[model samples]
Target: MLIDFLEFMISASNDSYIFLAGISAVIGAILPLSTIIFANFYEKSTVQTNDLYWELKREVNNSKAFIEGFNKIIYLGDNREIFNSTLKLFKLISYILILLWVLVGVGYIANVSKKPLDSFIISCSTLALISLLIYLPRILSRFQRELPIKVENKSCSINEIYNIFDVKGKGEDKLFYEEILVPTLSIVNTNSKLFIRYNQNLPLNNYKVFYSIQNKNKERLFINIGLLIKNKDFKNIHYTIGNEVSNTDTVQNKFSSIPFGIISKFNEIDSKNSFIYILDSLNQILYTGEVKCIFNSETKISKYTIKTYIDKSPNGHISKLLQNNEKEVHLLDDQQKLTPYYLLDYN
Candidate 1:
């Protein structure tokens, strides 16, 4: 009986087979097209606010609204269990319809001709369609990933300096100094080797040294100096900070030898002022030395330095020198040996 039915299908008229295949193809095409249209509508209905903070707050406050709206669009107000069941049923129906379409298309092609050219064309078309279906999601995801992120334009100014550094007033009455910790994490961008030297032995309590700030996870937060210092702050303190090694001949990479330093403050009082050590890299530090304020009466400039060896440990921790007279002398000798190291000098 099955063989007789197969024989009847093979001997059937091309017109009848073509009509059946066309109808099946149209119905199969419409189901997926309607699915796409409904999927787009579902996407539009679930559009989220651009601000992540506000969007999360809104969701937390009115979580049910999202669920209800999503259900109304995707499942026609049905619960998740019912929606899932219906989805499985629809998928099964789609698969069945696709199988039927392929079977009908093959039957129509067979009825029309027994030629190799016709079979080759049908096979190529089916393979191409399958390939398109397989890769369509990946292509769409790639398109979304390549979209540019929107960022608000921030105008650069000197006031931004206050935002970068933690400023505090120290002292009382007639004389006072502003103690600031300019976070080296944000400002150090150059590949240059930064050296902080204590030109004179003043006091360790007065000056700020290069330090690292880590989060709860113990990860360092990195920031671009170019973005932070694109204003008057760069111009005002550019001379005080050196980004070049003195002896350029010994340095193979000239750009990498550019010295970098941070200016602590600009003040009229010579005795009260101090310089903060800005490192070339966030990980680098002044291992051992005391920073001192040496006010040049003639030059009217305050010079601050940490006469020390800058070294990194295996565990990513900076080694600190024992604060004593002997270590201080050793640090001075080390600084003298390190000829091309930069200093923090300000007028």
Candidate 2:
């Protein structure tokens, strides 16, 4: 069918030849323009940089081995060199094909004008151009893989806020509570200030902390606390846990600190204690810590302190799920240790 079409084009009258040349000229012009348009659209579709890229960029700059491996894999290595060479070759061939098509159209016009010498010179360009077009699809079929520049690792930490208070008996036997120091939660991040925010992938349902009050008889009272970290600018890295307004059912700004108070009966004995267990969305324990409460019977006061003591390292399933075979990227903080009350000292 292609051979018959070429023969028909060759045997056509001068006017018909000119018309065919006009069509080829339009196609020659449109091919590169269409390619440029598609390239622009694809560039716009893929975002060049994001937070993950910036984070990785900082780490890549600090590690010599990592930077060397990354560049070799993504940019400066043999794979990239070969791809770049192939890209240049195909672009050169496409340009030659386009120029040859223009020459052929000009030859047809020259033939119609009765200039055989110019017609022959232009017609000679056709053989190379036709051969290139026949093999164009094969060369153009190869695609390149772009190296990834982003990595995201989500982590959560649980810290306890300690608040101390003094209690005194009033003249009418009424008890008055005095705030000594407001309890504030301290979230520990050694290398980066990355904290989990409720708005991001960190959801309130993923974790819950429990507080309890136990008397001498071992009777216990329990309270549930939800995790909600909030801040005006997420980039600032300083975040505070949002306090739930009692009974109003509305979220409020962070209080002076995480505050809890206990009122014992005139001679009742009780010990207040709290502990937090960090969990993923699937309810798997990631970390657990204790919040100690010290009661002062002589001074009629109490002290509450929380410290994370242990972190359950990733199990086999979690490690396998987070691993990617295509690229070797560092995501785990293996050196990170769970400390008791680390956030309190982290000013």
Indicate which candidate wins on lDDT.
2
**Clashes by residue pair, model 1:** 197-305, 197-306, 198-305, 198-306, 198-307, 242-259, 243-258, 243-259, 244-259
Candidate 1: segments with Cα more than 4 A from true spot: 1-16, 49-90, 127-347
All-Cα superposition RMSD per candidate:
20.4, 19.2
lDDT of 1 by residue, 198-263 (tens): 221111121223322222222321111221222112312221224334444343443343323221
Q: Total clashing residue pairs per candidate?
A: 9, 0
Native-referenced Cα lDDT, model 2: 0.34
TM-score of each: 0.27, 0.24
Residue lDDT tens for model 2, 140-242 = 4333334243111112122111000121112111110011111222222222232211121111122333333234444332233333232111111233222
lDDT (CA) for every model shown?
0.32, 0.34
